[model samples]
Target: MRNTSDISISVVVSCTAQTAALLPWTLKAVMAQTSPSHDIIVVENSAVPELPSMPAREARRLRLLHLPGAARPALRNAGLAAAQGVLVAFCDSGDLWKPSYLAIMREMWRVEPRLLLAYGDAVPLQGDTWGTERGFANAPTGFWDGQRSLGPLLSVFDQPPMPRLLEFQPFLPSGLVAQRGFLERVGGWDTACTLLPGHDFATALRLARHALFGIMQRAMVGVRPEADGPAHAQAVNMGEARILERALARDETLWSQAQVIRAAIVRRRQAALAIAFARGDLAAVQEIAALLPQQERSSPTLLKLGLAALPAPLRRAGSAALFGLGASRTSLRWPGN
Candidate 1:
């Protein structure tokens, strides 16, 4: 392994046909890293041809790999094999980075050689709902448009993490850099996690427990969110469920911990569905209702709210059945009716 001060990070960015709109933004951001030594890896999992950076542009070590799946954890593993850098940073295609991203992360690792992973804040962009980064400093509300509530959980060596990996991941994948040796030591993403909520979070969780890690309180990237994007949520849920299931099967030793995390995530997802229902989001409600197994959904808070509004007898009966909400009745139970 190379020393942190001398480390060159191999940055891996994920892309698909659907995320093409973000290529210019994401790659340019990664390319803009302060430290000139970092290399960029663009993994194209979509059927679309590789992104067009003019032939006139130069990337001495820039490379692109075709992975053929949106879930390119496998491709990431391959990148690990091909990487010449001492560290690896994961970037998502639809995200942008702060100018000092690579430099700051490298400095942090160099300062603390035992640190296994390090990451910071991510600012998200939802279409048509925000402003250009210009004049961001003077905004009274704050420069960040939508700051997630759970960014701080993963910045530690020990703490009771929020239950769901998706809801409060200690480390958001984008902007996170890990020592190449640690990644190889722990083994890469759990391939068995065909789909699960926190590939990044889960990996970090495992690493934090087993290795020394570090955190920097700085803003590092821009994540894009689609306005009321239903399919995205569905994919998110599908991905989480699959990942959690895989986590359980992958490490029998961690099955107990995985169960705790999955239960919390399940409840979180169920609450999301109920919120969509109460807000009369027929599509989101239906999608959330249909995205997983019957025994897998719940909205205890919503159920309690519903029960609170009802006579005790009806509340008891209704609550007992969970309003019979599941894939079969999803279409039948939209909020309006």
Candidate 2:
């Protein structure tokens, strides 16, 4: 068992100057930690102006690594290497961790020293919410939904229903804290998904090989899902997947997981399309849906088609009835209604 006393944790948060506004909430949450990380590395990826003028003394122990060429995986890898702690947690620019976020992770790790990768329920920030109404909402529309289409991709030993992955689009980047050794074993965040789309899914698929993980029933982090520049991110994410597949070319064992990975990717792509359609952006819905592999596009398109086929009166009727249904629902169980 790794001695907790020797454990130092690193929380990686990155932002360009353009997004610096989002990092403060994250920094605030980290500073609020009752169980302080041994080291907190905030990788400033912004080119124009770096992190805000906030004093370093605001947080107990903090270090800022300024990387102008930073991408998500590069920042994560740098933070991981720079991390003096045995455990590492991630909080992105627009996210906020719950008070006990780090503490709960510390306790869980302390209890099971062998545990490698662990993640839990994430409270979605509407900006980032991609699917699921209970996930995060903006007025009449849900920016993100908890529904996951590819549920089977999650590989924890006591895994959730594979189907649930379909509704909630399992494996969020914001709600995870993992051991450095385990991360090293799995090769850190695959820069492949570093873009926008499959990074989380690819990370989940690759990281699962390292352990039988646990799911914290309570939400500990707020994840904003709005991806303003998804095209570029998706392109990068796909490139990373290809890179990862190449890296694993010789390993049949890990390659075995590719099918699950593929399924998860398909679900992820579909979920985004679902949300795009709901947003009433027919062009975006068409563009993204067409990007899906032909065979894979069928179900989601059919689902969209089915939804589009709905009589306007009936759709409006359901919406009217649901107006009374409220905005959010909480469940650690499968999120589908």
Candidate 3:
């Protein structure tokens, strides 16, 4: 195991002009870290680059990179390339970090020298309020036991006896800290996944194939809720589907797990279809439904597809009833349900 006494960390904060206002709070949190990073890099992808004013002490470690109109994946890759620390951490301008976050990560590396990637849990934040739901609330049961520890990282290619890391997305970018070398070895973020919401998940999925992972069970970061509404949800589902498909094509070894990957793709499409149905988006519902195989399409799914052709008023009423019923029957509910 390498000596951890000289660990240096660099934080990458990615933002756009739209989120510039939240940068100050994010930087403030970073500056307050118990174990400060070697540097803080802000990568902004906006037409007009604007930054929050930092005090001299904080400003000394700050560097700004302008990637005009670059997407999140591109901005993050640039940050990875520019980071000078052995360890690199990521946070969005709208997110917050607990003071002990870096300290906990440093200790994790100290204790487990082989750890390639480690992430903490995050609480949901909306403006000034912190939501009770944790970022991993939607993850598979028993996957994260709310304890700080290191463990083997499993991938979708793993068989049933092992918990597949990609079974459900668990890592939040803001809560993640990874070895710089591991990230570079994986070729950084997926630039092709531009405009996709799950680029972080894609990165994590790739890394899972190469190394062991650690988790700090505590909520050490604050994450703003993703934009609500059907369109955003549909986009997320589509992005996840694309990531899974790309994964399958790139690695023939994964073909052994083809059934699992295909099932996950179908689920993402079904989720997109459900979101469209709930929002009474008939066109989207039909579009997503057509992507599903006939065998995978259930009777209720067909009913919803047929209802999409009805008059707007009738369609909306049917949608509302179906949505409410589905919600009520859902066994796996996130916080605030």
The lDDT of each candidate is: 0.57, 0.58, 0.75
Off by over 4 Å in 1: 1-5, 46-51, 54-57, 126-167, 194-204, 226-242, 255-266, 269-273, 276-337
Tens digit per residue, CA lDDT, model 1, 1-337: 3354587788887776666676877777777766854567777776447666644444665788887765756767767766778888887777777787777777666555666776665555665233343222222332132222223322334332223233434355665678888888888754655355334545655654553545555556566643224334444544555555555676687655765766755754565565454444445555656654567744544343445456657755654565454232332111000
- The prediction achieving the highest TM-score against the true structure is 3
Which portions of model 3 show Cα errors greater than 4 Å? Answer: 1-5, 47-50, 145-165, 310-323, 326-337
Question: Between 1 and 2, whose TM-score is larger?
Answer: 1
Scanning candidate 1 in windows of ten residues, the lowest lDDT window is 328-337
Q: Which residue pairs overlap in candidate 1's backbone? A: 154-170, 195-242, 195-243, 196-239, 196-240, 196-243, 197-240
Model 3 per-residue lDDT tens digits across residues 158-211: 212212554567667788788999888878877776667565667767766654
All candidates: TM-score: 0.65, 0.64, 0.86
TM-score of 1: 0.65
How does candidate 2 score on lDDT? 0.58
Off by over 4 Å in 2: 1-6, 47-60, 126-168, 228-251, 254-337
2 or 3, greater by lDDT: 3
Residue-wise C-alpha lDDT for candidate 2, range 65-93, written one tens digit per residue: 87777777777777887887777888777
Provide the lowest-lDDT 10-residue window in model 2: 328-337
